[model samples]
Target chain A: MSKLAHMFLLLFAMAGITYLIRMLPLVFFRKKIKSRYIRSLLFYIPYAVLSAMTFPFILYSTGNFSAAIVGTAVALIAAAFRLSLIIVAVLSCAAVFVAVLIL
Target chain B: MEQSPLKFKHGIKDGLPIGLGYLSVAFAFGVQASILGLPALFSTLISMTNLTSAGQLAGITIIAALGSVAEIMLVQLVINSRYFLMGVSLSQKADATFTTGKRFIAAAFITDEIFAVAISKRQAINFKYFIGLAVLPYIGWTIGTVLGAFSGDILPANLQAALGIALYAMFIAIIFPPAVKALNICFTVFSAALLSCACYYIPFIRNNLSEGFAIIICALVSAAVAAAIFPVKEKDNE
Candidate 1:
């Protein structure tokens, strides 16, 4: 299959799932979720998912292992300081660029 | 209950910062899309249709890995499920003006930032305000993607490689603030990371589990375990 066609199919599936998840609940369900387990699970899911996606994979992101490590460290520190997403991302990328140069 | 032009203007005013923030992250996504050899138009369309950062990034992985349709659908379901909660939460904030038709229209705009801004409003939201709030960010996100996709082609190889970490950095920025606030969240993040690391390293598991599936498993297990252990109080639920 063509790359464009494949991408479109994936996009359609993603868009459809996402739209339904948001729209169905908003349009039909007015009640707050009652279960504590579900609520806690929901609260924690984003953090967990992000963590899983970020680590290990991030180490491979920059191609250079040392550069990626530098980037990850910078990212962690900047984010811990409560920096905005843009600032943290830029700092991390900048750190990697420097690491690539020096090493 | 009537939708007022003034309120719509206020919504646009509120959305500006969010639009600005989306620019950098969306640019990273665009770069990643280009790296994956996706056309700029499709990358922009992903932003236009999805309006999400993590989900789109995950979609890129699935596409790059040649994951099946069911895989993408399932991954999107797991990753974007937070929107379900946001949508349900925002439903209470909608005034009588939010008719069924309006609800459908508004649903497309219910992003994390948009929902946060909408829910924080003192007054109940109307369709006009919601639309106004979503427009600028949508435009910003698409524009950023376009810029990134085009620029990725011209950037030096070293620089493009460095920029590859941009989305992951954003992910760290997102999870860190919350992780620091609560001990349970800290544990959840680390455990998920460890699990994901294992998946990446272990030969047998690594060979069998696709990237999408590994993420799904790690996230669900870590979250479920944390939820069972922590069981955040009802009022603490966000």
Candidate 2:
């Protein structure tokens, strides 16, 4: 198969999987949801997903511990203070990039 | 009395920033896709169809890395798993007022930013507002990809890196507000970071795992661990 064909097949598979995962809960669980535990579990999922997505890239940018440390420190401070997301992200990225450049 | 057209105007209002933000990031993705030797149109179409941030980003990486179909599917599932929760939460906001078609349409356009803005609105999420919200971002994402793909030559390399930062910044913006009120979120963020680092250093996992799979593992593992340790009390959501 051609690379384009291969890429499309993969994309279709991904679209199907993603839609199923996202849609199932809403469609299947549409009626009165009785499980308190399930509801509670659902509440934390977003936070967990966000963390998993963002944390590692911040640390491993330069393949060093220090860069991650400084980047995390800057992000934590900025985020904790409720700085704008763009500002905090730019600062953190700049911090990592600069740290990598300097060290 | 018919609701004023202005009632729906907010969707466009809120979507504007999101649309502008999406342009740069989507463009970056297009450039990356081009760099990987994929046609620019492919990247733009993916953005149009998927309308997801991390999933698309991971998809390109996985495709470039030449991962298997199973791995790609699994990675997409894992990376986008949170949307399941978001969809459920959104259903509550949508209430029974939404029909199946409406739900599907909303589901397709539902990015984290869009979800956040939609849920925050005091009014019922009418179709008009939802379409308004989806349209601009869709245009921004598609056009951005096309532009990036075509202009790959003229753009400076550093600018692309800077544009990539918009995505992370968007995440921070989304995560910060709620995180301030909740300690679990902070822990979850840190835990995710730690897990990601471990995945990076661990030779076998680093070498064997595709980016999408790595993301799935990190998200599920960290969320699972956090759930176990800090199990949200049943009363909290109530």
Candidate 3:
């Protein structure tokens, strides 16, 4: 298959699943979903998913591993204070940019 | 209630920060996706259709690794499934002004940030407010992708390389604030990381399990274990 077609097929599958996930609950649930286990599961998914995705890969995302580490450390510190997302992102980028330059 | 122009404007105002934030993050996504050899046009298309950073990025991995259809579907289901809860939570916020059809339309743009704003609104949301709330961020994401995609040609190599770190930084900014607030969450995230690190290094597991599957396993197990150990505060779940 052509690469574009392959990409489109993959993206289409993703879009369909996500849209269903987002739309189903709103359409079906008039009352709040009261299942505590499900609720807790939902509550923790974002943190867990983002954590799994970010780390390990973050160490390898930059041009240099050391640069990625420095950038990630700076970002965590910025986020610890609940700073704006943009500020944290820029700070992390700048940290990596400088780290790569120096090392 | 009538479709109020004032409410729509307020929604737009509320969406401004989200739009600005998406512009930067989606710009990072664009650069990252393009760096991975994805065409700029498809990157923009992903943003336009998905409006999610992690899901789209993970999907890119699946595509890059030539993951199968079942793998792609399952991974997206696991990663994007949290929106199901958000949708249920936001349904209560929809006012009588919304019709059945409008509800479906509104759900199309029910994103994390958009839902946060909509749910926090003092008044029940109408279709107009939801539209204004979702439109700007949607545009910002797509436009940022376009800029990042094309900017690859213009940006010097060093700067482009630095921009790659933006995705990691952005993810850190997202998870850190919440992780710090809750001890169990701290444990959950770390455990998930450790598990993936093992998967990345363990040749038997690493060779057999794709990145998408590894992510699905790590996410479900970590969240489930955390929930069992530290069930969310009852009040906060409401």
Clashes of each: 0, 0, 0
Model 2, B1-238: lDDT tens digits are 1344324576787799989877866776676576656677777778777888778877877777666799988877767766776777677767454678677666777777788787776655666777788778888988988887777656565444434444555566567667777788767766776787787779988898766667777777767766667777645652
| lDDT (C-alpha) at residue B85 in model 2 | 66
Give the deviation of candidate 3 from the true structure as CA RMSD. 2.1
From the highest TM-score down, the ranking of the candidates is 1, 3, 2
DockQ of 2: 0.44
TM-scores for all candidates: the values are 0.96, 0.81, 0.95
| Model 3: fnat (fraction of native contacts) | 0.76
lDDT of 3 by residue, B23-64 (tens): 888888888888888888888888898898889889887876
Docking class of 1: high
Among residues 3 or more apart in sequence or in different chains, the pairs in candidate 3 whose N, CA or C atoms overlap within 3 Å are none
lDDT of 3 by residue, A1-103 (tens): 9877877888898888888888787777668777788889888888788888886888888768888889889998999989887889899889888898998
* DockQ per candidate, 2 decimals: 0.85, 0.44, 0.77
Q: List the residue pairs that clash in candidate 1.
A: none
Order of the predicted models by DockQ, top scorer first: 1, 3, 2
Q: Which stretches of candidate 3 lie over 4 Å from their true place?
A: B1-6
* lDDT of prediction 1: 0.90
- Candidate 1 reaches a DockQ of 0.85
Q: List per-prediction Cα lDDT, in the order shown.
A: 0.90, 0.69, 0.83
